[model samples]
Target: MATHLTRRGSIYYLRRRIPLHLTEQYNGKREITRSLGTKSRPEAERLARAISVELDREWQAASEAAAMTAEGKGKPKIDPRYYDLAGAYELAELEEQHAAEVDELHADADRLEKLLAIVERRREQASAGNASKAATISAEARKPRSGAKGNSVSLESVIELWRRDRQPTAKTVDAVTRAVREAGDPDIHAVSRQVVIAMRDKWIEAGNSVATVNKKIGFIRLLLGIAKSRGMIDSNPAEGAELPPPKRAVELRKPYDPEQAEAVMAATAAMQATDPAMYWLPRLARWTGARLNELHQLRVEDVQERDGHPGLLLTNEGEHADGVAMALKNDGSRRWVPLAGPVLGFAMWAKGRTGPLFPAKANKYGNVSDSFSKRYGKLLRNVVKITDKRVTFHSWRHGFADMCRHAGVSAEVRMALMGHAEGGGAAAAYGAGDGLPPAMLIDGIKRINGDSA
Candidate 1:
């Protein structure tokens, strides 16, 4: 039979009347009905075709049940609970279809008269344990999640709350906001697992890396988990989204040789007359082995004494002049990096300022490492003629690490100084020296400096 659409209130439903021949054997029900769950007529029409296919499958099941009845061949006694459930779905379908009609089904009649309770319990049973496992096995599973779908918060509101409370980077907050807005901005509860899978596919098609795609998906999952914790969504849509296999690590950038390093340091001297931020940032990175953002975000106050020797404090806890927030990449990234001999000279050059030492290079996110990065890129490529893309500003940090390695510094000492994460096992937990001594860091730098000279 051809499927048809009918509206009860604003929601469209899929309905197909049972043929005369089947009505007598099919529990005397004259029509098959299910909520299309959407008001859009076009979407409802497309969904009607799927419900019609479901109705065909139900007809096959009913035919088998009827044959068993006719031959008296199947299980002799059927459980009343089974038919009771069908009655529940049937009654709810009836009520939604006839909402304008009488409201006199007495509460004393039966507990299942609460049709919503039965439907909800059935949904819970379907989703309890193995179903979650099944969802993991498949690329996508879209079904009625276990929660009250009646009340839902908007996806945009959830993102705003997450950003405010979670305090991710401005760049990170922007990326997540853009990605969610791109994913159609449905209510948080309405975002099914299939939607998350589709987003993964869309990002892959647009040429994002496996790492980037996974990170974006991770952000979505993390946000949904927050929503779930607050009872806004029943489940996280991004829980089992697939990711590409891990990519092989590539070493794309290398530090300058002694001659190249000496030339770059000399160029910074000429630049100091025009722009001290440009001059000092690269020079500090050369000696201290700090990330560009770490150096760029430093306040004058960050340069202070460590064990009677000058050191640069790299941390997220500083009280900036404008009070813009800051964060380190990880916990280990917060430490006091001792200034070497060359850096002590720059420290004396940069003392007595209460604000950022590189205020001119600062931007809205609190660090304009990009400004310095671009400026240095030109110097390295156009002027110094080191055409390799790998040997940019970051290469100076690499140059320091290489110096540490060539000086036979211990792995743990290098890691601690660089603010890398604690290494694996009991070693990371138990082997606690407060930090590397200033003299060691100085020694590592002096060897490199002497070589360049």
Candidate 2:
């Protein structure tokens, strides 16, 4: 009798020759033993001995079975479900064997199909919860009067509508127009998900931060939402689109410290004596933290006393020489910002009754850029020690916000002062509260003036 062994698919096989001496019924179950690996025939014989030992141990345990009538059955009966479980385990074992052979092909079609089914089930479960949360947030955002006005239109159309309706001071209208034009193509209705993703990739390629891309995408989403509401599109493609993850928040620029502050004041004082119009512009900015356009548009009548205290009134509409009426950036932006002592002093010194606070010849908005840089640039450089970070006219507003934070002003008070629309439930319920109570403005003033109290 000769025996042979072979391997196939990680399985071992053995063939045995049966002797012809006995009758076929008593030929002793033609041996077909599986191989355990061995280096030589003696090693193979040793493995065979181990197998014989195991079999004898099993026979000893089953000696009682031979005494029972049930032992006459050829094989034990197996439940159908047991076979099914065994088939599943066998399939799993085969898959593990296949995985070892094809390592890179793990996520094949079958696996993808199973994964998709799980994902869809999870999404269905989450849909209702997400919708409810969105509705709650939208409802709260609509509570304030400013919020209502703000909601009537989107931020995309704010400048266009402002220019059309409000005859804003020429400088203001121009500035807003530039901002709008720079934001170009407000109709992002045709922007696809792939387009947005590409745009984000391009931004990253250009070395922009994820936060920067997110900010632009946020504005893009706002535009798309507005376009949908206005019937410009049937759907907002930006909705449900994944945005790039934001980076850590950066610290905001703060107000100049005392020595730096003195340099700015000294520069303004010197400029006041030399170039009065240019000097008063930055002075009012530092004093009021007003937007550049706001300072540029000031008229004599806009500065007045309310209840024996000086206040500045702002309107969306600016009068041309011909007296045409127009709306401001939005209805919410038409509210007044109170003027403190420094702002009033700067206004009085300028002494303009019916024209711009820093009046320029027609079509000369950009002309003041050089004059502005010359006056405050050096002083800001000396103070901040970084020429790039030197105070711009816009920095006044940023600096004022920083001062407010340093003074421990409440978020509500600071937001109201900055003309930000309230979206919180409590803020919306209370409304604007008759124009940011004078005390808060006074407190803001004291902080800027370096008053300890």
TM-score of each prediction:
0.55, 0.47
Best by TM-score: 1
Where model 2 places Cα greater than 4 Å from the true spot, the runs are 1-191, 203-216, 230-235, 240-253, 320-330, 342-344, 351-354, 361-385, 408-410, 423-453
- Model 1: per-residue Cα lDDT over 254-292, one tens digit each: 988888888887777777758877788887887778888
Alpha carbon lDDT of each predicted model: 0.66, 0.50
lDDT tens digits by residue: candidate 2, 58-141: 545454544354457655665788767657755654564455435424534666588569755754675564545433433432
Q: Per-residue lDDT for 26 in model 2?
A: 37
TM-score of 2: 0.47
Q: List clashing residue pairs in candidate 1.
A: none
